[model samples]
Target chain A: MGQTTAEKIFAAHLRDEPFPGTKVIDIDRVLCHEITTPVAIADLEARGKDRVFDNTKIKAVIDHVTPAKDSKTALQAKMLRDWAHRHDIKDFFDVGRNGVCHAIFPEKGYIRPGFTVIMGDSHTCTHGAFGAFAAGIGTTDLEVGMLKGVCAFREPKTIRINLNGKLPAGVYAKDAILFVIGQIGVNGATDRVIEFHGSVVEAMSMESRMTLCNMAIEAGGTSGICQPDAVTVDYLWPFISGEFASKKAALTEYGKWCADADAAYEKVLDFDMSQIGPQVTYGYKPDCVKPVAEMVGTPVDQVYIGSCTNGRLEDLRIAAKILKGKKIVDSVRGIVSPATPQVFQDALKEGIIDIFMQAGFCVTNPTCGACLGMSNGVLSDGEVCASTTNRNFAGRMGKGGMVHLMSPATAAATALAGSIALAKP
Target chain B: MKKIFGGPVLCLDRSDINTDEIIPAKYLTEVTKEALKPYILEDLSLDGFDAKGAPLKNAQVIVTRGNFGCGSSREHAPWVFEVNNIHTIIAESYARIFRQNMFNCGMLAIELPKAQIDTLVDMAKGGALVVSVDLPAQRISATADGREESFSFELSPFDKALVEAGGWVEFADARY
Candidate 1:
């Protein structure tokens, strides 16, 4: 039988020889955020477990409700900070230290090829861009992972997505993935390992690939990964302070790195990126997507470009290039949040932040603000906003507010026209 | 696991019933799990669904066509159902994380074909439907209109054990 990518990762981590149904494999890294950490700790304490099993391997970040949204969220963040401190966990990232769990880990080199990672946040699958076997778990499941430094999962089937040809002008990785979801529907890739191949994925930047893998959850995919290439190597070089050879060696040693020629997939999806367009969701779900031309001139109240999904440096660069020296229309409220502290600093050094500010945009700190409707920039009743975030579920930005999901370029264009507009550059 | 006789399998009969439809993101920050009860199904566009807040009142079983829980892997979707007296859910299929969330919370989710679900919904329409889910036997039997019908499903041994032990946390409590 042809082993899937998940099986290969599991086989490598298993204590015994791997013929997998379920095994409590060793976890290399585990991630928790403020919302989940409190619940996990409360569960652990109730069960008489006083400490995390492996504090060094665990990282806690306070991003979602960071800068403390309310008194309750503030208390939870403080509790997590104190607990992480008590554990002497060196990787613990407080509000200012870490930006977003998914983005910052890769920025700091915590996620690399061949590693098995699990985070309390579903977007943890974002690390799959680096060939990491990452998945999301519930608060209680996180407790189990913390208790034993491992968690068991049913080996999943694999789905191969081949992206051939080149994307059209103004189209991006976000549009491609959104096109995949639109065709397959939300649950089309349910519980499967979605592996990307062919020329289009090969051409995407590490940041763009992260955007693609991050939304695999939107299509009910467990993990979405692409084979590492020169782009990945280049991205990791700065993180490792320069380890080109070692990174290549580690990835190669993680045998069964790619699917075999004869490997069988439960489903195979092919996309000619030429057919894709600058995409945006019309309604609540991420799969409710349409092209920019179709959605043009749909009025918007606010436009946000950030999140673990599309808040990286490249995303800001593209949006900034379009919005340079042009003031955001008087009606639209433009906001951009760079994904990580590194991305924020890089954007600042590159004058991207200044361009955004000059366009009358609010360039905020690296927090998942207003993405999940918890913190600042929240929408009011019956308001609609253009967002670069992943999920646009009902009441995502605020109570009775609607979100239209789009890429940073489209979002910037929306700021210019005060409606759903496509990027021209 | 104990045999559960779930009252009136409320046929939502929709595809892609996402977590947001179950509970929106606004109420996600509210304290206490019980606070979700009023907000449950508050955003779904179901016919006759009261937007002012109409929860699944006495319905113990929720039957859907396919993809019962799709977008967003919020475990609270299942947790909210478990808290609001939802014991068993019969669906044609479920998204990955949502199904696992259901099992971990001991809110039983069983897969039945849309054809079988159509039959079950038809039977439900005939009169009051009493759906009995046998966790160990992996069978769901429905009694309605003075007739009884049963269908078989499958569950992994580990998930069955979790169901038998009530929930994952409880199972963890016993073992660890």
Candidate 2:
């Protein structure tokens, strides 16, 4: 049988002695933000290893706790900053320069097709949308990857997710992926690589594709990826400069990285997007999604439209279109954040920020804030937030807050109605 | 690290217990392990416990349902258990990163089917019972009245070796 995308990648980087099992493979790129980097720096110190495997391949960002917010967070960010400087890492992005690590990594061409990327944050799988074998490991393994350049891996079987048929009006990538997860429970793809394919997937934009891959971990997916195409090249073309020039020029050489036509997949799931609706999570989990049409009057206290999962320019544009020339309900507070600094600038130039501001939505710096309940748009007791971000686990946003996950359009419409409502089609 | 006479296995009885709940992102600001133990379940509501309410005080092992440790790849989740001196965890299944994090901390995370998990969980609910785990033998036994009811399990030899030699640091120290 022909090799799957995961099989092909692992085969190329497989180590000796372990052969097909427990292969020790080289990690091409690594990324970390303040919340994850400080502990990793401490790990390296404890290992008595002062050197990183390759400083150029490692990039650190100040995203999770931007502007510090508190003295402790400030100390942590400063520690990571000092460590990066002492190690002479060239790609360190301080606050205002860096944005959410997942969104900015691909924008900078730090993550490329056919290369494996690892990060301390769980959404590292977001880069897999570019046809790479990317995944999230914990801080210890992340530190180990920095010190040794290689990390252990077990070959994962591939689960092919076929996104067949065109999406119906008001339905989107967020709805489609949420539908797929609801079909198979959270642990449906445990330790398995999810390869999204089919005509529907082929036609999706890079930002939409990222939304699909970003939540793969929510389904217990080892990683999620989409096959690369001309769209991928166009998106990354501008970022090719400096040390990455020669490395990126060889992108065409990695053309053989996609799954073979004859490959034997472990399992294949066919999702017809035509039947899916504008979905939203009513409970405390991503997989608890139901059609927004059926959930019209579920009251909400806030609306959030940003995160690695749904904070791209297209997402912002969708929200802007729905929210323009309108004000949010008097009691509700809404916040919009761009996924990265460049996305923020692009939105500003395009007047998307004005649309949000005019709609009574607060625009904040590009950070993963409020998405993980750290800051910016955190919830108070008895509050319900209709959010575009991933995961709505209990106590996720606040000590006693509830979250409803939805698309930006849905989130905006909900804000306007002062309750969970469907977006204008 | 051979045979653990561990567990008055406290039952969480829940699934999708993400790392954020175990150790919230607010506490992740600290670089070192210091000040982490007190915030393991910082804002949880538990029964039969004091105001601090970290009920794992008397537990060396915890039992939970499937998809335990489901969200963000925070290594602090396992560190919370380790600092509480939790030696083992029994679950129906576990998220990959969380399971690996447990192994890296030299903490045993054993997965079994629902029926088996129910058996173990029920045994613990009988008050102050133990899961006598024999690591090399790949079997765990819960004894009563001088008779042993044993359950078999499968652990890859590679993982067994790592556990026997303690976890990541020891293995790395030997290699480097």
Candidate 3:
């Protein structure tokens, strides 16, 4: 029986056959963020299992409500900081040094092909872009991963999503993924790994691939993965140069993680990317998508472009290209937070920050605060935001606020128009 | 752990009842489960649904439509329900992580067919529906306005074991 990439990775990491069709797999990396880890740390402390299995294997960050939105949030960060220090986990990232967990982890080369990674945040699936089997787990599973270095799962199954044809002008990985989610509905890929394949995926940059994989959870997928090819090698080349003999050698080694030509899949979906347009989500669901042209002139009070999904340097450059030499409408408030300090620094060197500021967008520090309605740029009640972040769930950005998920280009265009608008090709 | 449990049913009557609706993200900073109690479904906007009012305050079980508890991998969603003593959730389907989170917390997240969910929703609309879950038998029965109906469901052996041991932590403590 041929095995998919996810199956291959699972088999390689298998530590126990706990039950029929269930495997206890050794995890290579355990990602932790303040919002969820504090509870796990507290539980571990209560159980007298306060030690981490491997401190180096764990990466901790305080990004969610950075700068301590309140005393409670501050305490959450404090608990995680004290725990990380006590455990001697040196990869701990604090305020100013931290970015969104998904972005910063990969940026720092913590993920690699064929690794099994688990985190308590849903967007942890973002790391699957590196050909790893990464999934978002709950606190109990996270604690187990931290303590025993293992997590249990059902035998792996896969849904192959083949994005074929060339993307049309102004269309991007965000649109292709949004279109896929709209077809699958929210629970379309439940309990299954989505292996993104085909020429479209082959051409996407790492940033775009991360954006695609990050929303796998939105479609109820365990993870979204891409084959580790030359693109993957190039993305990690700088950090991994000393580890591999050469880029070609690294590519050949990572190539082992790719699915077999005849890999079996539970379901296969084919999408024609050329048919997609710049996409925007309406209503309160990420899957409630429509071509931005269909939503032209729909009023928006705010525009936000940042998150693990679309806050990378490429996303910033794309939005900056649209906003250059232009000013956002007075009725709209625009904000952009680069995904990491590196991305922010790179954008600053490229004058992307100047473009955003001149265009009236507030450039905030790297933090995931506003996306979940914690702080930074939270929307007021009844406000509508055209955002480049994933998830349009009701009140996701604030109480009674509406979030319309779009690509950074669409978000920049909407900011200029003070309404939902498509970016000019 | 008890194999059979039942209580007054509170039907959300909507698909895609996400975690953000169950427990908004702003409250995630609170480390204790009890701190999440008052805000359960605070941001949810369904017709005639008051998150803090009698309908939710008095209910001990939740019946909703497809894709219940979608969005975000926040265990706070399940913790909020656990704090409120609403231990069972019946739906047509669930978001993957949220479903697992429920099981991890030693709570019941039952998945019925769409047809069975329709019957439950209709029964719930009849003003007072009481649901009884028999875990050993894998059966769920609903009674409303003198009418009694039952449906059969299945849980994987692993999930069954986890629930039997009262969550993953307990299950792991014995083995790991």
RMSD in Å for model 1: 2.6
Clashes of 2: 0
Q: Compose the digit string of candidate 3's lDDT tens values, residues A331-423.
A: 999999998999999999999999999999998999998899999899999999998899899899998899999999999999999999989
Highest-TM-score candidate: 3
Ranking by DockQ: 3, 2, 1
Q: What is the CAPRI rating of model 2's predicted complex?
A: medium
lDDT of each: 0.80, 0.81, 0.91
Question: What lDDT tens digits, residue by residue, belong to model 3 across residues B88-126?
Answer: 989888888888888888888998898988888888777
Q: Tell me the TM-score of model 3.
A: 0.98
2 against 3, candidate with superior TM-score = 3
Query: How many residue pairs in model 1 have overlapping backbones?
Result: 0
- Which regions of candidate 3 fall more than 4 Å away from where they truly are? B1-4
Pairs that clash in candidate 1: none
Please write out the lDDT profile of model 2 over residues B1-176, one tens digit for every residue: 33243555577776777787788877787776756887876644344434254446777777788888888899888887777777688888899999887776667888778897777667656655566777767778774334456787777655665566677656655654
TM-score of each: 0.93, 0.95, 0.98
lDDT tens readout by residue for model 2, A30-92 = 787788778878767766876788899898888996978999899889988998899898999
Best by lDDT: 3
> How far is B28's C-alpha from truth in model 2 (Å)?
1.5
lDDT tens per residue, model 1, A1-425: 66667667878887532223655567888888877667677667766885877888988888886788688888778878887888888898886787988888888878877678887778888998887788887766787777777766777688999999998878888888888888887877888888888899988999899999999888888888777666776677677545545866544544346666777799888888877779999977778889889999999999999999999999999999999999999998888888888899999999999999999999888888789887768999888999989888777788788999988999998999998988886
Give the Å shift of residue A26 in candidate 2. Answer: 0.6
